[model samples]
Each structure stands twice: as C-alpha cells, then as structure tokens.
Target: MSDIFRYIQKYQNRSLKELPFTHVDALIFAQLSYIDYRTIRNIYAKPKLKQIAHLLDLQEVEAGYLSGKDNRRLLLALAHAKRYQNIQLINETKIINEETCEQFHALTFAYKQMYYIVFEGTDTSILGWKEDLHMLVYPVVPAQQDGVRYLEQMLKHPFKKAIVVGHSKGGSIATYASLHVNKKVQRKIKAIYNFDGPALQSVESLEPIQNRYYKFVTQATFFGLFFENEENYRIVKSNERWLLQHNLYTWMIEDTNFIYLDQLDSRFYQINRKARDALLSLTHQERETFIVSLSEIFDDNQITDVAQLTNSWSQTSIMLLRSLTKVEKEKRDAIMKTVGLVVSEMLRR
Candidate 1:
C-alpha cells in the first residue's frame, strides 16, 4: 500500500488553488512540525517553505527525530511541491523545562488567510513521556497552556480560518486548545485532525469541538488508546505490526487518503490499557509525587532525554535510588504502592 511519501510525489506539481488543501496535506504539515528546523536555520523570522526546502538536502536525516523513516524524503517533497511552496511557517517553539517537566514544540503554517497549527508529538525524552503521563491526571499541563496561548494569539490575526493538526501528544494538545479557545475562535477552526493521538481523560471534553474534530489511529494502536476515554476514533490499516504502527510512515495510504480499517487490533491494547488504567488510578497527591520523583531522578543525573540516561543506566539507577531516599516519608508509601502496581502489571502481562 502507498504511504504519505508517495502521496507527496503524486501531488507535488498541483497548486492549492487547483486542488484545495486536504486532510492529507494537514497530516503532512503536522508530521513536518517535528523537524528540528534550528539545525538548518535561525527561523525566528518565520521562513517560507522554499527556505526550509532548500536546506533539506544538507540535513542529516538520521539526526532527525523521524530517523529511519520517510519523513525527510516527504519533507523534501513538500519543499518541492507547488501546493505548499507559498506557505510560511510561523510561531515555531521548542521548549524543554526540567523544573516543569515540560517538552513542547509547535509550528504554524500561514497561507491562504488561514493558520494551520501543528503540534509536534513527543520526542525521545523520558520527560516527554512523563508529560504525557501528566495528561492522565492533570486538567492542564504546561504544554497545553502554551498551545492555547499560541492559538489565541494566532487567531487574533487576520486569518479568517484555521485548521489544527497534531500527531501523538500534540494531537491531544491540539484538541485541548481547540476545545478551550473562545467560541469566537472555535468558530474559525475549519477542522481538527488528530493522527493517532492519545485521548483526553474525558471524551465529553470534546463536546465543544466535536463537529470539527477527526481522529485516525492505526489498527494496532496502543498510544492512541492509552488513556480511558471513549473517543470515537477511526481505524486505519498499517503496514507495520503492534507498537510499530504508531509510526506515521507505516500508515498505509491510497490516493491521498489513509486505508481505513473496520476495527482495531485490540490484542496489544488490552493488557497495556490495564497497566495504564492502574497508573491513572493514582490519587491526585500521589500523581504529583509521581511526577516530582521522576523529575528529580532524571534532573539529578544531569540528563534530559532517554538516549542520555540509557547510555549510563548504572549511574542513572544510582541517582534514582539516592533521590528516592530523599522523598518525604508520606510519599514513600505512595511510591511503594505504585511499585506494587507495576509488579502486578508485569506478572499479568
């Protein structure tokens, strides 16, 4: 089956005027937001597509977060595409704060009097994963606040319409911002596409934006189904198996659209959902301790991402143990209870 890279090749010469922007195009830009554009140019000035495209050939593909995938190739295609050449990328931000345990990145494509906001999924940081965990208990995470602020500011501009798109964690954030933005701003959103994004804790939260929202997930989705929300997400066929389906590059596309599936591959989701549900059961105070303990452990090791910590597991483990000892006496019981849940999950799995 074809994928998005092929879709880019098929549509490169077509203009948005000739063929209006489709949901597929939104997905393409959403995926592109993950690029570390700073590696190529200082884009505080909001560069056009041509500028970004010109630098793609020199970009180290492996250095990209979408390593071993067609993201770079697809980006190159987007750069060359007549449809996207007129687009300007703006409001780009990548912030990682150890104190807040926040990892956020977003880019907005401004064109045709519209704002196409793309919230990037998580990077390979343990902290990013922790932020995703924050969604389990947090009514609002730091990144979500940033997303809403960004949305509000952008909407105030002359753009008459908007589309919000995101993958993974960004998808959830995109949904959150779309839901919370004022009624005036919400009316301007043309559509909200979430590609295999995790669910917000309550599906009812989407009531404000339901008519404008769409969610697509791979058949063997775990990330999309991670939290306990009855979101009415559609299923798409994937070329890969199990957790690997989370990779957008593997999602099968045909003629500019995803190959829709009748149902999900629930085998992988069930056991994992149980583990996630258990974690989400933590009391609000326990959840706070959980976040703090993790932040302290990783912060003390002087590391940010998973790659750094994994490279020195022994030292990291030592640091974590030392941090655990400093936890308040009351928190120890909660931590121990969490450990028990994890142990029980392992045995069940």
Candidate 2:
C-alpha cells in the first residue's frame, strides 16, 4: 500500500518465474522482528536440516541443503541465492582463508532462490514495515567471542561489493570485520549498518572501522548508554514508533520509517564517569593480576562446600599476589573501596 512496500514487492516479485520455490516463505515472512535473532542462530548452528525442517514445519526436502550439520553454511548459501542474479551472500567464517572466500563468492547471486524452507501451515514469522520501506530481518542468536575471532570469519567471506548489516552483537561483529577485513575486501564494502549494537571497549582505537559505519538507536535505549565512548559515532534517526523503542516492540514503521532521538540521560553520563575513573586507577599489571585470580576461582576443583574449605587460599593468593608485590586481598579491598567511591560520585553527579 505504501511506496516502500510497493518497491519491495516489485523487487521481490520480479522474475518470479525464475525464482526458486524455496524462497516463498522467507519472502512472505520477511519483516524484521526481535524474535528472529535466536531462531536463525539455532538454525545456523544445528547440523541437521531435518531438525530445522521440524522446527519450521517444513519438509526436509524443502530446506536448501539436506545436511543441517552446518547451519551457517546453509543460511549463508540461502542468503547468496535469494537476491537478484548478480548479488551474492555468505555467512559465518571465524577465520579467513582462501577456501572461505571462494565458497562465499561461488554462492553469490543465489538470492533468486530460497535460503530457508518453512514447514507447511506454520506461520510464526512476523513482518513489519518501516516508513514505506519493507525490511526482511532474521535475528541471529547472540554469540560471545573472547575477542575478534568472529570478525575474522566474516572478513574472510569474499565479495566484490556488499552491504554489511546486523543487530546488536552482529552489528559489532560487522563493525570489527569491516575494520580488519582484507584490504581487497574492505575496499569492496558498500555500507556498514548496525542497529543498536553495543560499542567495543576499544572503539576509539579503531578509526578505520568508525568512519564507515552507520549506527541506529532508539531514544532512551539503555544500550546506547553502556558503551565506553560514542562521541565519534553517528546515530540513525526514526520517528516515534513503538517498535522503535529500545525493546523493538515499539517500532513504528510504514513506507518511510522514522528514527527518533532522546537526549542522552544524565544518569548514564554519571555511571560512565564512575566506571571510567575506577578503571583508570588500576595499572595494566594490576588488571592482569585481577583477571588471573578470577580465572583461578573459576577453574578451581572443589567438590562440595565442605571440601572447598580444604583448598588453599594461600596457594591462590600466592600466585595472584606474585603478579604484584602488593597483598592480593589488600589490593582487592582498595579496588572495591575505589568502586564504592566511584558509585557515590556518580550518584552525586
């Protein structure tokens, strides 16, 4: 009914005769919703297509690939196949290698077909419009990495020109991959779009990554407030839509979706200042010592509460305190005291 919807329908419906049958459900269910994130992630991680088929209520035959062992590969293959003849899509590569790029590039332009197949008569997928523009999003489940291993995987995916997009953690991964991607591939990226993803702690150091990204946030979304530094970042604006709320349930979308802004809350600034000050007090060596101590606590083998008492605090503290000449507990107490001070100052601010 709206101009954007009309445009999306035209684009989706064009070359229908050439389109593969597998794509019908995805097209019909193409609207973005918060629910899609976990579903798609599980679908990608599971190895058997039959399992996914069961979940989606589609026959195993309908899933693009017979094997579910590699959901990332299957979904990515579908992404590649679903677009027009020339567009290519690839998903999930933690480490870039020659083989990874080739697979991604090979699967390019598969968008005319279905990447995912739905079970018969099961219509759980929800679709919505932003302004007049219709968006198709399948939220991927959150993945936590020690650092940038996931970024490396995406970077390895080969593409001559592409638009990289994601929500939350996916958005952060998109940002990391865009910055550290191979020089050749980096040049090929057309755009980087992130929807309310948390910023990396070290974002300030990533000048190359920062310049090309477009970040969207809902006014008063707690996410925007949790980051280390957003002074260099940009925000995408939207009108007051319910889905546009931080929770995504408040998204107000039509043909021309609007993104709105709320002034950054004072509470967030106060919290940020407290955190920054506390972190600044610790030297790099002290930080490492603290982390090692925490790691030991997690790795210790204590059977029961009673048995755990037998474990030697002396040994743990010795190793921990060895990292610094200062007494381990004393240092910890100081840090806690500093934290309390930080919190008090924040409240005062």
Quote each prediction's TM-score.
0.84, 0.44
Stretch of 10 with least lDDT, candidate 1: 338-347
**lDDT value for model 2:** 0.37
Question: What is the lDDT of every predicted structure here?
Answer: 0.75, 0.37
Over 76-165, each residue of candidate 1 has an lDDT whose tens digit, in order, gives: 677787877778886677889866878999887888788888999988878797787678677778998888887888888664789999
Lowest summed-lDDT stretch of 10 residues in model 2?
Answer: 127-136
Error of 1 at 294 (Å): 2.8
- What lDDT is reached at residue 92 by model 1? 75
Cα RMSD (Å) between model 1 and the true structure? 4.3
Q: 190 in model 1: Cα distance from truth in Å? A: 0.5
Q: How many clashes in each candidate?
A: 0, 48
lDDT leader: 1
**lDDT by residue for model 2 (1-349), tens:** 2322333344453443555322122222221211122344355543232233234423332342212223333333333332332322223222212211111010111232222111111011110011000100111112223113333443354543444554544455456556656666666655565555556545346656556666666543434434546654434333333122343223333433433345544554454455445544565666645544443443453222212322554453444344344425655555455445544543453
177, model 1: CA deviation in Å? 0.4
Q: How high a TM-score does candidate 2 get?
A: 0.44
